[model samples]
Target: MKVNFKLACPLLLAATSAFAGGNNEPTAHRYISERIAQYGEAVERCEKIAASRPLPDESVIEQLRDYSIDDVRIFLITRSSLVSEICEKPELTELAYAIGVLEGADISGTPKEIVQNIKQLVFGEATWGLKKKYLELPVSVQNILKKTDYFDKPFDDIAILNAIENAKKP
Candidate 1:
């Protein structure tokens, strides 16, 4: 009995000291409210970012750089002439979303949005399509996409797939 009590005292003291430090975790209500507040702040920031951004397709052509929205509508003839030169719908409907993302991104933007958009598209689309399509796209289309303002440098299949996998971690 004496030996058992001696060992248990030290063990109990260690646990007591740890308990005395108090739990770093918050209550369930506190955690939820904090997360909600964070989400609200994030939405506000994203709204501001989305507002300042242009429609993106306007920058595809060099000569049209100076044109405003009205200029494009009034001066530019039928269909803007750059659409067919860039992309087309995918063969499978399941792949359409990814194709559309690449096409939308194929227009124009900063390298940051381009990279992040590509990362997210590949990530999010895989959840729906159940497969990744970046590498499956034709080489020619890939080349055209590569030249677009959307495709950032180091746009490789491995990198994109890696991003998708990493995003799944807790």
Candidate 2:
């Protein structure tokens, strides 16, 4: 039987809430959380600056292009509802969704299929780590790897919003 790997939107929001607002998970289990908190701030700052500025000229765009993987990581972290009630940025939300897919697939497949599975799960997973591993894949498998994760339930945008809203409640 086929299994659906896609997480419900509410579920993803719940998980992000648990990770960010729950009791501190043991440090061994906290790499993603700590990383999220660190990067979330950076993403917020960048968003503020980018929003206030006029369309960046090519030179500024080039400078933004120099943003590192760490920057991407931070964007995903902050976008996950750790810092706000709603993740309004499509780019940030997409990044979080992709990372969640990769983390899920790594738990259930061969390293190669694991790589492909995640690439398929996230819209742009190939442009990152998968480029180096592309040659080892079969043509048929590559086709399978291009599909999106099937969602049995629609994502709950409000669950994340709720989590953010509840963060400071007594």
Best by lDDT: 2
Candidate 2 residue 15 Cα shift, in angstroms, is 1.1
- Determine which window of 10 residues in candidate 1 has minimal summed lDDT: 80-89
The TM-score of predicted model 2 comes to: 0.26
1-170 in candidate 2: lDDT tens per residue? Answer: 00112232223333544433223223312443333333344445544543343332344233323444334223323322222223334544554654565466433212223234333543344333334343343443333223322111122223323343354257
RMSD per prediction, one decimal?
24.5, 18.4
Write down the TM-score for model 1. 0.25
Candidate 1 — which residues are off by over 4 angstroms?
1-26, 57-145, 150-170
